[model samples]
Target chain A: MTYLIEGRDGPWELVVGLEVHAQVISQSKLFSGASASYGGEPNTHVSLVDAGFPGMLPVINRECVAQAVRTGLGLKARVNLESRFDRKNYFYADLPTGYQISQFTHPIIGEGAIEIELADGSTRMIGITRLHLEQDAGKSMHDQDPARSFIDLNRAGVALMEIVSEPDIRTPEEAGAYLRKLRMILRYLGTCDGNMEEGSMRADVNVSVRKAGEPFRTRCEIKNVNSIRYVMQAIEVEAVRQVEIWEGGGSVDQETRLFDPARSETRSLRSKEDAHDYRYFPDPDLLPLVIEEAWVQDLAAHLPELPDAKCQRFQDEYGIPRYDAGVLVAEQATADFYETVARGRDPRLAANWVIGDFFAALNRTGRTIQDSPISADALGGMLDLITDGTINGKIAKDVFEEMLESGESAAEIVERKGLRQVTDTGAIDAAVQAVLDKNPDKLAEYRSGKDKLFGFFVGQVMKAMAGKGNPALVNEALKKVL
Target chain B: MSLDPATVRRIARLARIGIDESDLPALQRELNGILGWIEQLNEVDIDNVEPMVGTGHAALRMREDVVTDGDAREAVLSNAPDTAGPYYTVPKVVE
Candidate 1:
């Protein structure tokens, strides 16, 4: 469904496209041998080329290039064998080179698409315009001192893959979904960490509004929205702001604006005069980036099974519901954990335990799949006990709780607690006879066709056995006796 | 394309070049002359031809991923216009 915001005139639909800057995960920076790790001492990761020394030249890092290709393949985009880097000439305190090396006319990754699953379980394809590699600017801290600004060149010359998207997003929800899906893909490929909080990944949101059927109007770029929630809020707020401008008989100027998350508003960062004529030209130092066709195929072949394929396989192979499959495949680790527990076990039961009590326990303890107290193998072991009738379902819950507390194996816990189910029919028959003797009036009524009393007799029998009686065996014994 | 004095002045400002107002006319003429000479290439019919971005067909050479350089804080900061405690200091920036 198309999301619309009601205005004085009518409902207006928003058009959004996002440019996400994901820092490529590599050991070194793009053109230098400085550490690419985050939170280093200021300027500690700087090389002569990164710090823009006189006559210093840049050398591309091969692993960074491979990372970009891996990301492109994960997005299902076409990778160009040959792409050129250009110099975007500009000046800032942080940009010591007076120009940024970026891809302007040609990029490594061409047109592609990502499937974003919406909250309604409906999927939509968002077009990816291109992905280009670029160098990052250094950090300029304004508040480090009262009278002097501080410059940290650690982030300078870091490889950044700027993924641009076509304006296919019509709602903030779609935008958020697209970002999340993109982040998940990048993380799965291990190309980028997708850490928006640490500034590894960020989006510049472009938003415009018009009547439902009208053509796209001018868009205002919301710069450097760090979080997905802020991106969504910025789009809605900016779209409403645009609608007001259009209705008020004032033209919206095309320019960059900053999303003030605190105020929930966007303010102009620069007017037309501040618009840059980057004077982009091919970089003279670096040659055109080219890769062998076989290299791309190799990268594609080695890619881990992505989320969509894993989700579909889970439903088809395990007979799990679509919702359960989606939940399991949201993270690679969770999916792997589920597979370990589900293999050679009752899949539906495994799904129930993992998605139900297991997830609840993790949430209650503020732990993730990696740090969960209940290991996959341990859960599988518990399932094995349930299958073999060593314990009943109710007793298994107690065993699971004990396992959570003591980090012991399910068998060990069951043994220590002596919570084994009584599967012997001879013993179960005596327990059933004792229950019937105690509940004489209920048994009489049950024989008189008061079928509701059957449950009362079964509960009494299980309780008489200290909840150790196999439910199925107890049921059988009671039926035969009655 | 022809360059006018105003356009030249704007370009100079954008490039952060300090050009005297009196030099605008001369700079405009020189810039236009260069552009006119470059415009001569438009006379050639190059249809179906790939635009060449560089002179060489060599692919970009890549270096191994390793942190072999840096940690020369004193050397790296040697050329800084102003420095304080391994940091490059500038006049207070408001934004």
Candidate 2:
């Protein structure tokens, strides 16, 4: 399905590109040896190099470089053996150095693509233009004081990988899907945490609009959108704004804008005259970064199975459907948990239980897979009870609920509640006969071609047996009786 | 390779260096002289020479990712013109 904006002249198409800045996961800053952890005391993580004191030089962090390489490999990008750092000069309160040390002319990674799956199960390959390494500026808090803004340099000098995408996204949903898939890949690679709420990952969105079969129009960049949902919303409102301008006999001026999520609109951040002249030149303080081919191969060899491969393997190995595999492999911990539960039990049953009641329980109680109330072994144990005829499916739900509340194993809950399934044929027959005796009219109707009444008799038998009767046995006994 | 008055003023503005309008002619002449000197390199007939990045042929040396510095907040903020509590403060810049 095509996503188009209904303009007065014709349908207008949207073109979107995203530049995502992901903070590299390392113990120290990219240049200085200061701690790069989030939420430190103000100015506590600032080093002389980070503070930009005169005559202080920067040395690269080996782990940070390896992390960038790991991320580049994860994206299936070409790792440039030789890359240089350049100084992008600008003035801002949060930036201690007048220029940001970024890769301008030669980026580290180039020409990669990520596959984004939309809501309709259709996938599209979004082209990655490049990924470069740069230093993050400190944060400024304007509301902290009446006359001044507070600056925190803890995040300054931290390494960030700016992943730029080609303008291939046609819809707002594709933008969201692209961000989600990129975050998933980053998290899977352990190069970045991909936490938007904590400011670990941020995006700059580029949006433009054009009539069908027309050339690309001027694109306005929306800067520093912190959340994935807001990215999607910004693209939508910005594209609509551009379409209206073009339809109103006006041209959209290219500029940097900010997404005001509260108003659900985008406003220009700077005018054309105030446009950025970054004056990029090679930094004299740092040398060119060169890596060996062997190092790249080593990093690529040790990467964990990525999400797509893991999702495919889950379907092939467990015989689960693609949808179930997708849900299970969204997170590494969840995939591991599913594998644990499906190790020896019936995999389809395991997937159904995990995706159904178990996930619902987690959501209802507000717990993650890492801190799930019931362990994988415990869930597997509950499935074991059902498979062995020790408990029926309905009884398992009760046991599951009890286990969630008390943090007990399924077997313990079953034993304490005495909710084992009554699998004996005689006992099931007696319960079925009692239910039929009590409901002769329904039975007469069932005999008179009202086959739907059979379900009511089964429900009555299970209720009489306290939801402990084996479901298959109840159905068989009901058929035998009537 | 020569600097015009407007280009000179723009450069000065971009660099945040305040200059008088009267200094444009002299500044433009000095900048053009410097550019003219650097432009002599274009006269050479070296078409296929690879660009030299740095003085040495060595790759950049990297440090271990360990926190060996920091924790002296007072020293870090010592040179700031103004500070509020433990933070460095500047005139409120919202954008």
Candidate 3:
């Protein structure tokens, strides 16, 4: 394994714990009925509750609670039956309330484990320390004006799920894997959309590198990693810097830092803020969230199969390879589409088409799986045409493009364009004979063990027939002639 | 956790609060009092009790190896201080 702490000596080890702030997947803000949509008119999504006005009290959104519970269930963490929001006292221009309402002593979820797949195809489980519900502070826009800092209250009181992890990660790969897994889980749970660029899912990485078997050192918290790639980059860069500092006989200070994505470097922000300094005490006005075991069970019952389970089942049930299963089940929408398209069809074929051509089309058109021009049924219809030999794979592509452009089915496209596979043996032999008669030199190459040129012959025959000839029959007749 | 004068000053600076020098003794006493109250957790044996991670049910989310919205270069860099086409610019960060 590469030295996790790059600049250090004396068998140093990286102890990485992540504090991931995921914006809860909800229609509105945490305490108010304001829209939580991103990139809306600046500060337009603010209510009195978000502004921290004198009379406004926090009214917890039940839908946000449901989303949090759903996320916890997905993580296999312990959902506290009684969790309460606490006031995290602080002073900032962005924090209009001068305090953030967050879960402190009584958090909603407890210990859980995340199975992260390594680059080697093996897996490791990272322990989830806690996941807390908190309201997000608004963004402090310093660049909005030359001489002033603007507060975008649109993010104020937005629900945030802070998923804290134990320092179980030992390598940068593991840390990266853990973060990606967490983001994937949040996205699947629909608790968070995991849009790191929009500041929806950010990470505060707690990194320290100590000698192997040594107790963890005072770790620095690198904050506001806005993208998964940036998070991993920050981890690698910071860990190496800490290790180098330690090796040079300097002490690692426990402070918060910021990652500059453009420069790919980490810089100190401020001293780390511990819980005690925040003066955390239960919010006096809001009552404790008294959830029952029955409620939790009901939520669990409604929980969809999470990533790991779905990946395994897809592998076993559909005979898809682990990599394909893992990919297919990464997103709930994509996985569902794969399942729908794979049903009663060749699983590998469905996966290839979905993950390959379908994905390319989606990307080219700037569409998501949810908002594709071709539905799962239409995709399945296209696959059926290929499987039943009604159209060759190449012909299916032409039909697929037609379907995308005209919003028609494979049958319609094949009929309209005369692109159906030519399965008639007599027609296929005639086309093959014509190609052979024209390409005696290539035929000689084929007879003399240059079998590769046989594909050229097949192509020539197809081109002569306007690509309407059945490829399988041509291959059969060509082999008989050889 | 008693807030001495120096500690009081540090906390004030950390919280970004301006405090009079003469008020140091009083602020220290109040902060110490608060820390002491919060220290009540020391009495309870949380030795093996894992810190709370999240609320609700426990499971992990994952996604397939697919890229979504990779072509948002212009839409993304639009919020930068200065941009040279697709990149965000700052005072040359590297000396």
Candidate 4:
């Protein structure tokens, strides 16, 4: 569906692009041997190279580079065998170095695409322009003091992969979906942790509004939106503001803006005149990064199965619906859990149980799959009792609840509670006959064209048998008597 | 390839250098002379030549991902003009 904003002139289309700064997961910083862990004592992770001591030079960390390569491969982007780092000169208290070493003219990864599925079950391919490596500045905490901002250098010189996207997102939902899919891919690749709350991943959103079939207008960039929801909301309010400006006969100016999430509006950070002029030039301290084809191939070969491929395989191999497969593969741990339960068993049944009750139980208890009270093996064992006619479905549910509460296996719970299914025809006939004798009026009504009363008979028969009677056998006995 | 006065002022402002109005003329002359000397490369006919990046032909060297340094907060912040606890302090630059 086309997303349009009805304007006084006509309908306006919102154009969006995102630049995501994903902190690379590694043991050390990009250039120094400082620990790259998230939280620490202030300035404890700062090395001389990170702190910009005079005559100190930066040496690249091999694992950071490999992490970037793995991420590029995950995105299906082109890995530039030879890439150079340039110094972007600026002055900031957070940046001890006067210049930040970043990939400017030549990025390490080029042109890739991510496929995002919308709520309507429709998919769109968002184009990725480039992915570059850069150093993150130290964090400045302005709330710590009345007159000065305290700087923590723990995050300084951390490796960040700035993934830039093309202006192909037409709606706010697409932006959210694109971010979610990108985060999922990064998490699967083990390149970035994708923890927005921890400040590991951040996005700068560019939004523009133009009438349909018209050329692009001046775009405003919203910097450092921490959450996906905020990114969507910022794009929406910014686009509406732009449309009002255009319709009111005022031209929009290109600038950088900050998203005030509390106010749900974007305010200008700087205008075009005061725009940053980062004097970029090649860094003399480091040589060009060059990798071999063999190394790239090895990384590609060892990559874990990505979400899309795993989703497709789940559908094909397990005979589950596409929606179920998509839900299962949203998280790697959940997908692994589903696979363990589905193996050598009724896959569709396993999927139904996992997607239905197991997920609901986890949500109710506020637990993740990693710490789920019921293991995959235990759930599969419960399914085994149902498949082998050891217990009826109704009894299985009670057993499942008991297993969850008491942490007992399904078979043990069933044997101890005497909740096994009564598959014997003799017992089922006796129960059905007793229900019929007690409900003679209802049976007469059921025989007299009240076909819906048949359900009532089945209910009563199962109730008489304490809900352990096999449903199919009860229905069979009830039909034979009628 | 020449440096105009306005361009010089803009460059100085971007570099956060305070330049005097009286010094603009001489600074422009010196900057233009430097650019003029480097502009000789534009006269050479080398259309297909690849830009040389660094002096050495060797690729960039990388070290293993190990926490071999850091944890000396005092040493790291020794040269700071102002300090707060273990943090380096500067005038509030909230954005």
Which scores better on lDDT, 3 or 4? 4
Q: A264-326, model 4: which lDDT tens digit per residue?
A: 999999746558688899999989998898998999999999999999999999999999999
Q: Model 1 - which docking category? A: medium
**In model 4, where do residues sit more than 4 Å from their true spots?**
none
Q: Rank the models by lDDT, top first.
A: 4, 2, 1, 3
User: Backbone clashes in each candidate structure, one number apiece?
Assistant: 0, 0, 26, 0
Name every residue pair that clashes in candidate 4: none
Candidate 2 lDDT over residue span A213-259, tens digit each: 88899999999999999999999899889999999999999899999
Q: Write the per-residue lDDT of candidate 4 for residues B1-95, one digit (tens) a residue.
A: 88789999989987779999999999999999999999998899888988777675679988999998899998899999999898999999986
- B-chain TM-scores per prediction: 0.80, 0.84, 0.54, 0.85
DockQ scores for all predicted structures: 0.70, 0.82, 0.05, 0.81
Sorted by DockQ (best first), the order is 2, 4, 1, 3
lDDT tens readout by residue for model 1, A1-482: 78888888888888999999999999999999989988888888899998889899999999999999999998889999999899999878788899999999989999999998888889999999999999999999898788888898989999999999999999999999999999989988999999999999999999998887898899889899999999999998999999999988898888899999899999988757857688899999988998999988998899999998998999999999999999998888999999999999999999999998899889988999999999999999999999988999989988988888899999999898899998899999998888888878888899899998889888998888889999988998888989
Candidate 3, residues A1-482, lDDT tens digits: the string is 44444342456677888889989877777777777767666656676667665777666777777788888888888888778778999777667778899989889888998989888888888999888889998766556445455555667777899999988887878888888888888877778888887788888888888876777788888877777777778888887788788778889887888898888889887545432377777776566676768878898898778888899899899998999988888788999999999999999999999988898999999999988999999999999989888888888888888888989988888888788778888888888888889988888888899879988988898898888777777788888987
- Which 10 residues in a row give candidate 1 chain A its minimum summed lDDT? A269-278
Error of 3 at A19 (Å): 0.8
Instruction: Tell me which of candidates 1 and 2 scores higher on TM-score.
Output: 2
What lDDT is reached at residue A265 by model 4? 96
Best-first order by TM-score: 2, 4, 1, 3
lDDT of 3 at A393: 83
Model 2 segments beyond 4 Å from truth?
Answer: none
Q: What lDDT is obtained when candidate 2 is compared to the true structure?
A: 0.92
Candidate 3 on B1-95: residue-level lDDT in tens?
A: 56678877877776778999988888888888889999997899888887653555432222221112122334333444654432333333211
The lDDT for every candidate, in the order shown, is 0.91, 0.92, 0.79, 0.93
